[model samples]
Target: DVKVTQSSRYLVKRTGEKVFLECVQDMDHENMFWYRQDPGLGLRLIYFSYDVKMKEKGDIPEGYSVSREKKERFSLILESASTNQTSMYLCASSFPMGLALDSSTDTQYFGPGTRLTVL
Candidate 1:
């Protein structure tokens, strides 16, 4: 089965600290994404990587950046954690879009999520 692994299940931090959340996927999928999920706001994309050393800033990437040094691993870095940044961060991966098998059917398999509590 395809799998995505998140490095942390929970974290607590003081405001202004840098934070890192790691994710790895075994399937060699070409698309990886990081998103923050809030109760009423749903999932907001933060960053994504399509290939090694390449990254794209998503809609809400102001406080975050990412790295894709290897095909199987992706990392999300919070330049400076803040109380308002506290939320569940999820990592997901999928095959490149527009495949013969209907890639839209691709449901992003999520990590357990890194629950960051910025104090």
Candidate 2:
């Protein structure tokens, strides 16, 4: 099974502090993603990297950015952590098991998310 690791399970930061969350995947998959889940609203993507040094902004990329210096590791950076940014951050990866998405049985497996609490 593919294993994804998050740098933290919980983080508490004061407002305006820069925050960094790290993620690593061992599957050597071609895709890595970062998302934040909030109450009422479902998971919203922050950014995704298909390969090292390659990144695409997801639905919500405002206050957040990502780095993929190595294929096995991806990092999410918050320029200024705020109370509004306090949410569950999840990291995910996907790989092709066979051919197409449905036929390949490729599914995104998420990490045990990091919960951020800002005051």
Candidate 3:
């Protein structure tokens, strides 16, 4: 089973603070993603990486950055946290796209999520 782990489950920080959220997948999946979910706004992708040392900016990458120094670990960084940045941050991992071997298909496994409150 693929297991994704987040460094923190709940976080509280003041505005302008630098925040780091860590994620790790035990299955050595090639793809990892980060998203911030808010009420009614839905899940907004922040960043993702398809391979080690490579990353792609997601829809809402304005105040966020990502790092993938190893195959199993990906990190999300908030350059300058703000009140508007408060949301439930999710980390996920999955097999490389286009590699659906069977009916189970390529499914993304998500972590419990980190609820960040920026005040």
* Candidate number achieving the greatest lDDT relative to the actual structure: 3
Listed per candidate, the RMSD to the true structure in angstroms reads 1.7, 2.2, 1.3
Instruction: Compute the lDDT of residue 40 as modeled in candidate 2.
Output: 98
Predicted structure 3: clash tally = 0
For model 3, the stretches where C-alpha displacement exceeds 4 angstroms are 100-104
Error of 3 at 97 (Å): 2.0
For candidate 1, which ten residues in a row score worst on lDDT? Answer: 98-107
Query: What's each prediction's clash count?
Result: 0, 0, 0
For candidate 3, lDDT tens digit of each residue in 61-83? Answer: 99999999999999999989999
After superposition, the stretches of candidate 1 with alpha carbons farther than 4 Å from their true spots are 99-105
Q: Which runs of model 2 end up more than 4 angstroms from their true locations? A: 96-105
Which structure among the candidates has the greatest TM-score?
3
